[model samples]
Target: MIRHTVGRLVSTVVIALTLALFALPMLWLAAAPFDASPAITASLPQFTLDNFAAILDNPYALGSIRNSLIQGGGAAVLVVVLAALAAYALSRVRVPGRDLLLYLLLLLSSVVTGTAAMVPIFELATRLNLIDTHLGVILVVSGGLLPAAIFILKDFMDETPTSYEESARVFGASPLQILRDIVIPLVRPGLATIAVWALASVWGGFLFQFILLRDPDKAPGSVILYTLYTEGGSPKLDLISTFSLLYSLPVVLMYLFVSQRYGFRFHGGIKR
Candidate 1:
């Protein structure tokens, strides 16, 4: 009885400590944005909106948020559309070595990351006149995310009963029509998952956007956040905190909205 009690006590303490470790940073992030003179540690805020005002005055701060929205939203749309199409095709069609090909693509994409292939990517982008372009960054991000998106979506596709498609076919529905009218509705949760995943991936991404876009005006929040530092290489915690709060809000709001709408429970498409 004593051993069991001790084990439970120890587990409770460990869990509390783990929660505190994660919670402290979030607490600071929420509090420090409003602090008149923010610090590394979380404390009661001096309670001023001046930090936000200062962010507005910075030339690149708000624009960077817009740029981030454009890149993240664009890449997300492109990835979801392409991934849905490819996943559906691979699910319905019995092409030789199709599973092998999907696995190979997923493996290659994981192995040859943007950072690893940045040199070749840069060269290709330069040759294609894609340097310093938002479209370039969006395309590159979408390409990198597509394989995994397809892999995930394929499972949802596989789980969907083909009876609906067969019924649509009897009505003389084309493959595209069946996909649009029948399959898509059933697999919407998977689509939502992919959209959220893709957006999150691009939202936090820094390396590709930083490398591809040279214009400060076109830089995303991730890239601009990196520049929030003093000449002596110290971080500008005040601006960083303020901008980080603003930068984080969009994705957080999106996640909340999606979660409320769909409820992420899934065993293939959506748990029923």
Candidate 2:
């Protein structure tokens, strides 16, 4: 009992610190736009809404926010649908190179940084006349997300017993019908998690947007934030920070809201 208590204590402390570490930056970012006094500028917390006002008033910032939602939401939906089918196959089928394919998927998914894929992705997009197009950006971002989404979805699907599929088959359910009615409902939580993460990735991403899009109207918030970095003096620090904070708010809100609704759901049917 004493040993178990000590282990639990250690785990609790680690989890608390990990959450704090992640929350600190976002907390600081949320606070910065509200700090107004000069001495406070040195280091104090005087609150004002000017920063937020300035950001919302900026046409570029507003446009970028809208673009981010449309592009990210659409792309994530498309990717999740495609990934669900791919993951379903991976969970159910056995091909000649199946193990090898999965192994390569795990390896590629582990390669989180996408800097190396940019050149070829760009070349292909340009050749296909997809550059500066929202669809193009969506395609590449979805590709990057594919491996991770597959891994997550496949794990959830694998946890499901063969009996479920067998029972469905015995009932004369078509493969498509089984998938739509049974497997999908069973793994909806995993799908939600994948969709959330994918949306965040596309919304927060800058490299692809910066490279693939030349038009300000075509780019997302992160790319617009990059524009602020280049502007140096257009909106002022407080305004820029406020706009960024605003830009981030929707993503943060969605995460918090969805995580609340599906936090445990996302963990269901999976072994720790």
How many pairs collide in each candidate, listed in order?
0, 0
Tens-place lDDT digits, model 1, residues 1-272:
99999999999999999999999999999899899888886568899998899899999999999999999999999999999999999999999999999999999999988899999999999999999999999999999999999999998898888887898899899999998988888888888889988999999998999899999999999999999999899998889999999999999999899888877645344333
Best by TM-score: 1
lDDT of each: 0.91, 0.80
* CA RMSD of each candidate after superposition: 1.5, 4.1
Per-residue CA lDDT of model 2 for 114-174, tens digit only, reads 6887788899999999998888888888888888788788877877666777898998998
Residue pairs of candidate 2 with colliding backbone atoms? none
Backbone clashes (count) for model 2: 0
What local lDDT does model 2 show for residue 214? 91
For this target, which candidate reaches the highest lDDT against the unseen true structure? 1
